[model samples]
Target chain A: MLPRRLTRPRITLGSPVQLLLLAASFALAAYAGVRLLADDWFGVALWFVGLALLHDLVLLPLYTIADRAIVGGLGAVRRREWTPYVRVPAALSGLLLLVWFPLISGRVDRRYRTATGLQADVFLARWLLVTAVLFGGSALLLALRVRRAAQHRPPAAR
Target chain B: MRDPDAPRLPSSPGFWRSPLRGPWLTSVLGLVLLVGITVLFVTGLVSYAAYNPNLSPVNDKTPDKGILGFYLFAWPTSPHWLYRLNQGVHVTLGITMIPVLLAKLWSVVPRLFALPPARSLAHAVERISLVLLVGGALFEFVTGVLNVQLDYVFPGSFYPLHFYGAWVFFAAFVVHALLKMPTVLRNVRHLREEKNDLVSPRPAEPTVSRRGALGFTGGASLLLFATTAGQNFDGPLRRTALLAPHGGVDPGSGPNGFQINKTAVYAGIDAAETGEDVWRLVVTGRTGTVRLSRTQLAELPQHSGALPIACVEGWSTSDQWWRGVRLRDLAALVGHDDDPPDVFVESLQRRGAFRSAALRANQVADPRSLLALHVNGEELSSDHGYPARIIVPAAPGVLNTKWVTRMTFRGL
Candidate 1:
């Protein structure tokens, strides 16, 4: 278990706070489905369907994969791996999802730029390059550190 | 692979060089699947426009010509395995791909912000594409969520934003693809040169095994599949079961939000039973030839899918379908699937100035696209293309051809 201070920042599954929030949200959605907003059924329906997509389609899988990889495979590489590693996951994931907002909102002409305006394949290629450079740069730095450590070894008393 | 004895590296000092761990793999895979699935929808729209020239912006004004396009655009059909399959790809890919994409972005944040692209057109365009990709991903997730609950909530209208935003979605992916092309090729080349870390191991914590995580992922993904697939089990709710459900413009049979053009020219020739000699579909295009009898047609292998006919005008339906031949498969049967890039379909009507408004190959290649012969359970209805009709999911209605007599395959 992580210390309280650090754990405060991290979201844990099945925690009391998380469970309470989840329970409250579901209760609200159910209530709305049955009682509060029966007439405006379309919106309510959209809300529920949208909720499933948000969680099942995107969030959970992302986090699950991240948690498993970061926590399991490379956890032993650095004592402080959590901080920097999570930073990458946190920022990029948040940003990527954010940018897709207008289109996902189902507002095509009003919000999203038309397809002719944006060449999508090109964008993906550049994004990959950016990611590669980041990982590549990190590896280089680590190799440099290892080399310096070997060179600085003090002579034994022999 | 992991080395139990190796020291654990902290994330703070370096964002790059993280091993392909659970998070990294998940994120990368998620991004790949996410992009690929989104691309499927995008290309679907293009294929729709490509096939039925009536749906073209050039002919948008002539609503009469667009009647066929409308049905092609909006209706859904039965044996909807394609819908389930695409949904499977879309939902599962999004969930898994998002995090990996996130990690990938994180690794490169510094480069993005620092040494910012010069205020040149190239840099500006590049930055803009990135913005679209990031934003598009989020939008896809949220709306996709809304789409799933549509059956329970809205009840009637359950079409995903795929139908409405197809054109724009197409543009977004096109931009992303063009931007990433060079770099992707380079990276892929690099991948070829460097051993896949995914397959091998770095000298770190030996306990870390990608294989283990994969095993778990495989299991969990199966659970996801089972749970999701369970949510939608097809029954006899299709139109075939709705015996004579108000033949006079059955509003329920028509897709949601689609304006029924009550004036469709139902083939005057053989709308009812034709003698066996006339029942056969005639083929006309590049190499002119007419094949007799659907029985001869049925001799070819069949492909079936449960697909929704999505119209740009907003209508869809669910139907189980069994087709004797795919456009590709059919083209090959007539001996053209391999060679000719394009094929044109002809109806029984005489050709006019708009003679070229026929089916094309690009449209059928889409995953949910189909040329159906059966709806509900038995042979297709006379009103609904008795022998053959094209049914493309995510395609506008006009493109789906009813009463397909002949498919001519050629380089044209």
Candidate 2:
């Protein structure tokens, strides 16, 4: 049986193994923190915390608003059913942009060329081509589905 | 029952209108990450071990890595494709999993802004651990992605920062996984969605079903894999890896046109010193030192073997026909004729990280290992390690020291 002081707050607090493991996790994080701070403390610390805020406070809101606009704009035209066709392709393209932003934007052009002896300029064109394909493919699928549905309906009901 | 006085928007649990953001969706994504991240961590550790950090100070990039290096052993030499497969999988899979990770975060985001912060002492501790888990994940992924792109915006050297950051992230990740495993199992067992904070109290009409959302995420990951995995191969397929740094066609033409991580010029190799007349292969061991010129090295019987050069940056070249004197042959010249001992190799490059590297005794004895003099049928180009270079099987590209300088055997 555990003592009252330990268990009074919560059952988890009474588990010594859990507490010990938690302490170890904190210690490891601290060691990494100290080593990271030793060199570029300001940059490292800013990136560590700032990235989280950027995702939650900034990127998330921007995307959510964009998604809402898509939904709202389509709903007004009585074509809300077409949202998936637009959303899926947009989400996939946005993800590619997010991952390969540096290359696609040519931000690392000089350094990348010097290091690998290959041009970074190819990325921007390739990304645009890929985005076009995704949207085109999705729109084609939607057209097929719409045509099939119209053909299957009874004339009187239509 | 909905609280009449509940907070507005995101803090109120009513703002997130996705009907699909619930335990089932979160758990499915969690399961994918459970399998995917475990592979990432193991392969990441294997990539570290490939550097042979146990050699200390020479190849060891993470200096204060005390107990963290317990799993590292003398990396193998038999398969020859070992390092190539390890690095290719590590980098390619890491990029492929980004969409899944972002989706998982999006699923559980409401908890990040949960009001009052903590309801109890245990709750507060759990929240703090969540902070470490989230922060550590973003830090590792961002740094790793930036490095692959040749962007060095992040502060400090990539080696120690990544090594240490991995430990912190994995520590919290393991704890978080352990705590959530039971709940995840229970949630995934049933198709029935459970009510929780993740479930929107005022969800809008469903544009996409839960299964549809999962499929979209999986499809996104598949797309990334198609665009990224081609960098590991050769020929026409290599052009498909548009998202990877080495996806473009090889620079220049003909046989020596394949990828090179750094040019001779960029590595600070002085072309004047690397010339056949000035460069000398210095071999030292129990028999004392022997200095041999490039012409003399070619005179001592040449051997040819095909082997790939795999870089830590995750790009690799297909097997180039390398002709040279075997490392074991050189070791024999320095007295250890029967079994070649560990050797320390130095290079003429005046700059960069691994100007010198050490190899284990087994690596020295590998039949394929060479002091390569000619790549393809032609004499070596200045960009491809000029007068002479070390070429060992299944080792990281950096460990294959370039330009002939000196070698010390049996005392590493």
RMSD (Cα, Å) of model 2: 3.8
For model 1, report the TM-score of its A chain.
0.42
Q: Report the C-alpha lDDT of model 2 over B1-412, residue by residue, as the tens digit.
A: 3457555667768767788899999999999998988888898899999988887479888877777778999999968889999999988888889989988999999998788777755567778888778877888889999998978888888888778778878888888888788789889997554677899887878988989989988999999999988888878888989778888688768767888787887788887897767888899998999999999999987999999989887778888899999999999998999999989999888888888999888889998999998998878777788788889999999999888599999856
Please name the candidate that would achieve the greatest lDDT relative to the true structure: 2
Docking class of 1: incorrect
Where model 2 places Cα greater than 4 Å from the true spot, the runs are A1-18, A31-33, A156-158, B1-7, B191-193
Candidate 2: chain B TM-score equals 0.96
Residue B402 C-alpha lDDT in model 2? 82
Best by DockQ: 2
The worst-scoring run of ten residues by lDDT in candidate 1 chain B lies at B239-248
Worst 10 residues of 1 chain A by lDDT: A110-119
Q: Taking the tens digit of each residue's C-alpha lDDT, what string does model 1 give over A40-114?
A: 455634544454355444654566566556655555675344333343434343443343332223333221112
Q: Candidate 2, DockQ to 2 decimals?
A: 0.51
As a whole number from 0 to 100, the lDDT of residue B36 in candidate 2 is 88
Error of 1 at B280 (Å): 37
Candidate 1 ranges beyond 4 A from true positions: A1-158, B1-17, B21-35, B42-121, B151-169, B189-223, B230-412
